[model samples]
Target: MSDLVDKAKNFVAEKIANIKKPEATVTDVDFKNLSRDSVTFNAKVSVSNPYSTSIPICEISYTLKSATRMIASGTIPDPGSLPGNVTTVLDVPVKTPYTILVSLARDIGADWDIDYELDLGFTFDLPIIGDITLPLSTKGEIKLPTISDFF
Candidate 1:
């Protein structure tokens, strides 16, 4: 009897391990808007859902770093849902104050751009599998806003 129960547990574990999970990629990160006090950037995330229904996004947590300094970190709660069987592109807004940008002046002065590392956590509510968090990261340089952008 004990052996049968152990076998059943192993089978269940194998099935769960073989489940097809969603996949995601960070396509781009670009400047969006500039305010008097802060600048906003949009991180474009493309998620491919394998299931046949929409899955709710529990949260999107992110950290933006530049020159070894953390410029911004926060969580976006209940952003929305990922439609099943389709790849959806989501825009995540990351805002940084002028004060923080000033801290990265040395790096910016070198090339007129900011070298950044963005780490993103996409949490989704998956049926039977409970909640799962998919992590994605990207490193790139973003050009600073030019004088023409203000006009």
Candidate 2:
């Protein structure tokens, strides 16, 4: 009887270890809007769902960093669902106040751009597997608009 129980436990563990999970990637991060007080950027996330049916997105959490300093961090609650057997693109808005940007002037002044790392967490509900969080990160430089371009 003990031998049978051990075999059952091993089988279950192996099955769980080989389970197929979702995959995600951060495609791009670009400036979206600029206001007097704040600047907004959009992070594009593409997620592939393998399940047969749509899965509910629990939440999306993100942090934007520049020069090793955190510029902005926030969470989007219940963003939406991922279509089954296909990839879905989601936009996450990151807003930074002018004050914060002003503090990072040195980095921006060097090349009229900001070097940033965007970290994103995508959480989804999977049947039987419960909830899973997929982490994606990307680093790049974003050029600031020139004064003439604003016109």
Candidate 3:
């Protein structure tokens, strides 16, 4: 039983480490003259999981911070089960460059490090029969147009 938990945790950690960060390339930036509003475009993040296991639910979180200030944050479901490759679009108003951190948490239970005594919910009839947490994390960047560059 303990072994199973360790295996699950390792699996999740590896998967999270391998999960690719969202790639963003400015496809188009439209700034109207004399207007502060600008339309910034970038590709949505795409995450792929090759594990042949069923997860009750998968949640992905995105946090963006700039100059020690949190600018924006959001979360979306992993769309690997869908038909397409699962792309999420983010249309952010460029105020300044920011650092983006993306993390994934799932109910797979294969990668969770759970203390059997403390975690009552996961102790009974464990699906994977192991104490494991499958949370993973990665990060990327979004370059905001400088004030002078916008003009």
Pick by lDDT: which candidate is best? 1
| Backbone atom clashes (below 3 Å) for every candidate | 0, 0, 8
My TM-score estimates for the predictions, one after another, are: 0.96, 0.93, 0.30
Q: Please rank every candidate by lDDT, starting with the best.
A: 1, 2, 3
lDDT of 1 by residue, 1-151 (tens): 9999999999999999999988999999999998899999999989999999999999999999987789999999999898879999999999999999988888888888999999999999998889999999999999987889879
Residue-pair clash count for candidate 2 = 0
TM-score-based ranking, best first? 1, 2, 3
lDDT of 1 at 104: 88
Per-residue CA lDDT of model 3 for 1-151, tens digit only, reads 9999999999999976675332222233332233334222233323232333432223334443323444444444532231223433333232212122111112113343111100001011113333233333333333434568757
lDDT on C-alpha atoms for all candidate structures: 0.93, 0.90, 0.33
Q: Where does candidate 1 stray beyond 4 Å?
A: none
Off by over 4 Å in 2: none
